[model samples]
Target: MSDIQIRPVTENDHAAWLPLWQAYLTFYKTELSDAVIASTWARFLDRSEPTNAALAWQDGKAVGMVHFIYHRSNWSIANACYLQDLLVAPEQRGTGVGRLLIEHVYKTAKANGCDKVHWLTHETNATAIQLYERIAERPGYIQFRKMI
Candidate 1:
């Protein structure tokens, strides 16, 4: 925790950032096309886009990354922040990197005047669930979706 540094993803960080992003998608058993990946990276670097990304570095090595988005919400007057993606290197798990990244989002959301910050995890992600339980309440809202 003491050596970990979490910072915004800069334009020059593409190489350092790609592996972490690919690992995250792999963890979820999802495969995205190169075009989608390119677009997402572009959005992260675009200042006018509501999407943002941050990387966690330790000993000058990038070990984790988190991506979030800000959008208007009908339930709240202020914008809502969604923590869309978060991943820490397998070796870095249990070392507090994930928590630090989440805390970064919390602070960023507040600074941006967002009313809430939320995220979803697969039910089988017990490790993350434990951490989330300690930091947030379970709102008990089940999610349902259909792809067109």
Candidate 2:
């Protein structure tokens, strides 16, 4: 979408990013503490930190956001970037905002020399799945997670 743009999130955007962050949690029906939200925003804004991104407006409003971190990858000798969270305002869904956010992540990963950018969403998130399929190859391996 011509109206959308992706940029490194700055500290000045924390206030704008919060409601979108909360919405991302709400989309998954989860909750997070304000402190954690504050910390995450601070971490992303900190230039010293590695591998993070957010999508904002060409029109000057924060329409959507994505936050990812780089980490070791056993499959690749080079590091990989993992998308931790992505959110588009509910009103902005289906308007190409999600794909733009994803493309931004890929561009960021490429610029950083990452082997790949990867992430997962709930199986039931059909809308995102549809968009994901359009932009990237399907994952061959299934994911399993356990909280220790």
Candidate 3:
């Protein structure tokens, strides 16, 4: 396993975050823009922004990224930490980068007084599901979405 350094995203990381964001979009086949990604990065770096914390680092010469947010809910005991985006460059996959990101998220959730950590992945992402199953309970609910 490589020594994965995990930390909160900084403004300067925008250039580094681009490829990972693109990979995440490609992984899901979504077409998003640089401007949108820029805005998202701004929101993440803003301390007052509700859900903008991102974790990122250079895996040697390559970059890996993770973004997450905490949300309050009526049905939950405490705030739920939702992992908004997580992506490891294809070259870095299967070498512990993903696991490090998830572990970092888990620790972040616990530190923030969150009762749980939640995220959804495509049903077809078998490798991710394997890791998630080991660390999280699959909620018996399907996600519904609408473009705003």
Please, what are the lDDT tens digits per residue for candidate 2 over residues 98-133? 888888888888888898988888899998999988
Q: Give the TM-score of candidate 1.
A: 0.98
The lowest-lDDT stretch of 10 consecutive residues in candidate 2 is: 50-59
TM-score, ranked from best to worst = 1, 2, 3
Q: Which candidate would rank higher by lDDT, 1 or 3?
A: 1
Scanning candidate 3 in windows of ten residues, the lowest lDDT window is 53-62
Greater-TM-score candidate between 1 and 2? 1
Top-TM-score candidate index: 1
lDDT of 1 by residue, 63-98 (tens): 999999999999989999999999989999998999
In order, what lDDT does every prediction score?
A: 0.95, 0.83, 0.79
Clashing pairs in 3: 44-52
lDDT for model 3, on a 0 to 1 scale? 0.79
Candidate 1: the clashing residue pairs are none
Ranking, lDDT, top scorer first: 1, 2, 3
My TM-score estimates for the predictions, one after another, are 0.98, 0.92, 0.89
Enumerate clash totals for all models, in the order shown: 0, 0, 1
Which candidate has the highest lDDT of all?
1
